[model samples]
Target: MKKLINNFTYITFLGYIAFIPSGPYPISVFGIKLDILLGLVLLVLILPKITQIGKNYPSIFLISLLFYLVTTLLSVIFSEDIVFSTSKWFSMLGYILVSILAPIAIDNYSKIKFSRLFLLVVAVVISFFIIHMALSYGLDKPQRFYLGFDPTAPANYQSDSGVEDIVDPNMTAIGLTLSVIVYLPNFFDSHHTKRRKTLEILAFAIITFGAFLTLSRTAILSFSLSLVLAFTMLSISSKSIQNILTQISKLFCLLLLVMIFLFGIYTLSPSFINGFFARIENIESGKEDRTDLISDTLSIFFSDNKNILFGQGYHITNPHNEFLRNLTSSGIFSLIAFLFFLYTLYFCILKKIKGNYWRYFSALSIYIYIYS
Candidate 1:
């Protein structure tokens, strides 16, 4: 019965991951969002075994998490709108709980293997679904997939009325980004059969194409940086020149194949390519830039002495940068706590990279850091 419950908990956790991209969509039950619902269910399932779960995690991780949670809660007292801040605080708590508890449920080698396979399957499914939807009903004016959103609706109409479901392309891209990062190394693994390698390559191509459709610069940049960093780490860890040369050859071949695939996409949809380049051009031209927002966020963060300690509170503003967001939402202490938590978490994952199955987790940790 205990084993059965753990398996169920792990499956629920995977469901949470699968729906992470759909977070902004208005899919709900009894007015509760699906992701929140899954999280709540997961919390309930684990509560009975909370002590057991807690025992598995490191002391530093738990201590940092607790401190982070406490700081966020404390920030709520200083919020201008207590009700809204309280709601946001609860949401943050859910995310923290999910992050800490979900992976602990995947205890052994079998679960680790299955989790990777599940994420790969999810990546392929998401890519196919988004690409098919985009091709069939057509992309929005921005040539981006507006999945779970009413493409015809005005931005203000969707935002003000709160009736139309909205899906942020950037968030959707993040899901694909994670999926790609987690399974990308498999393509280079020599243990796989030829057929398996071919399938993995196909999946990678489809997912990469889907990520392109989102046209999220952050997602694209994160994926690129993570891939480069992952390879660099692998190369550094390699014991011999022959192994390093082999990695380089594989990377070159992969890049060539990706280029050809992208060329094929451009031939099929020149407009899409144009749109993507236009986005890049806009960013380069400062027409669609975050520098101003980030600048303003910094100003607000340091405006008052009280804000320096307790922050302005939740739902204050979207800083877009996680560190800035934390600094603005819960002040310096929360930021410190967050940094500590991240350090411990990354350190833990770093230690596990020596194991074969843990490499994917290490890659994921790198991807999350870059993405953030």
Candidate 2:
């Protein structure tokens, strides 16, 4: 019985990874839609080891999460649409559940094999998506998939990022960035054969290729910053020659990946490089929608004293900035809770983890902040 439960746990994690890239999430048990990943994660948390997992997580993070949940509930009570607010609150809870459970589930001791399998699965999914996008670009059938969103919407046309069956292209980029951070380092550290590393490098390269196709400035900028940060952090922390060489190899591989990305763009779509630059041009010229979004959100935020404290409500929809979105939707209390939660996760929980785990987590945190 115990062995069966462990097998189920591992299978659950694999299923979650498989579902991540493209999700309609149409499955629901009761009336509540099950977040497949979080559902599996929660199952993993049900074991006897769950107590230790809880203890392993930072106390500050747990406190902040509690506060955040309370604030979300309060926001729902005061919200215009209770249904929407309630749904969002539950979703946030799922996210927190997954975040806390993931580190515990993939920790160094018992579940390390599951962790490797999860990474490999994610890497394969990313590779498949990159191949699909390349074919889509070459054939020029549909510009972008825009999955789970209205294709005919004006906003769809405004954003040139390659969404490719993901809810949002920017989100796709963020996911890919995270996969790169986690797996790329392993490519360096793994004592796998030359052929195996080549395959891994191809996967990483393809992931990078997908990121460029998104043309998401935030994604690109955040990924760049995270790489530099990861490199610097790894370098400073390592005194062993093997560790230092591993860091250097990661940097070299990254640079090579960029070169391959540029060449791929030129070969596949010669004008893509220009389009990417045009996007930057628009941002620089203050023509980007995000600029106006920030301005308008700030105006609404300060428009009323009540909103300044409680928030404009979740239905406002277009904040485009994560912190501001939380501020405008949930309220100042939620925002404070959120900031504290992030601080604790990165500074406390991530820092407490030994080995290259911290490097990957730090990169992920940086990506989340920038993508937000």
Candidate 3:
């Protein structure tokens, strides 16, 4: 039984890398309409003894999460659509519960290394998808369902499900950025072999290219922020002024190369530049209505101050932002609990995690979640 659970744990870890749900549409297989990877992760967490793999979490964090869950449950009870609210609540609860067990599933440093390798493999797979999509676009061909490819859009489009094997383009871009970020530090690690460094560089370039093809402004912005934060962390952690200067020089050189490359592309393709800039211009002009949506969310929150305690009861779905979604969906109480839990979790991860990779990953994961 333990062996079976162990196998499932490894499978789930690999699934997270290879099959993260990202498509605008979900692919169904054998009548299963949900994310297979997430499902496997749920199972890993459910199996006896699997949850014991990681260090114990803080009692306060657990208590806060429980409080948040209770608030969510109360919101569901008062929800206009009880059935839908309940379903969504359970789904979110399951994800949160299972994710807490991720470190348990990994269980060791070796497993973490394997997970990074798995991520690299996934990056290679994404490169293929990017290439295929680029070819299709260049040929002016219709989207191929088999490739899980969608045309580039200025913003995230609401879709019922994502395709199999390929994630949504925006999510794909985010994932690619995550891969690049994880490896970025290692690329500069002087202790690594020449061959390894070469591979790391290639991987970074490929994943960055994939992100470029996605054309997702949110992903791009978030990725850029993560890079900045990562460099800041590195600089702060350095022991000497010389180390700081070295890091700064490396960052500057990398940015210069990227800028030069982008400039070259802009000069070479006038139409592409016009189209891309036009999308940015549209965003600047507030054509996306996101600001209006945020305004509406604020109005909803203030219209009934009583709702601040118990929320609007799950019927209001389009918050357009995570903080508003938490506030209006589960009330101010839940939002506070959630924020506290996040703070505790981040603190614990930074203090307890043994490896650099996992530490960076935890920070990046939280940043991605809040932004997403």
User: Highest lDDT, which number?
Assistant: 1
Ordered by lDDT, highest first, the candidates read: 1, 3, 2
Q: For candidate 2, what is the TM-score?
A: 0.78
Q: Look at candidate 1 and give me any clashing residue pairs.
A: none
Q: What tens digits encode model 1's per-residue C-alpha lDDT throughout 225-290?
A: 666566666776788999788767866875688679879888888888788878877773564577
Which residue ranges in model 1 land beyond 4 Å of their true spot?
21-25, 137-141, 152-164, 184-191, 237-239, 284-287, 357-372
Q: What is the C-alpha lDDT profile of model 2 across 32-96, one tens digit per residue? A: 44455446455545445556755786677778778877876777777767788777777666656
| Most accurate candidate by TM-score | 1
Which portions of model 3 miss their true places by more than 4 Å? 21-25, 37-46, 50-55, 139-168, 183-191, 233-239, 284-287, 314-316, 354-369
lDDT to native, each model: 0.72, 0.62, 0.63
- Cα lDDT of candidate 3 equals 0.63
Q: Give the per-residue lDDT digits (tens) of candidate 3, residues 56-96.
A: 67776677778878878888887757898888887787667
Better of 1 and 3 by lDDT: 1
How many pairs in model 2 have backbone atoms within 3 A of each other, for residues 3 or more apart or on separate chains, i.e. clashes? 0
- Runs of candidate 2 with Cα error greater than 4 angstroms are 23-54, 102-110, 113-117, 126-130, 136-142, 145-166, 233-253, 284-288, 314-316, 355-372
The ten-residue window of minimal lDDT in model 1 covers 148-157
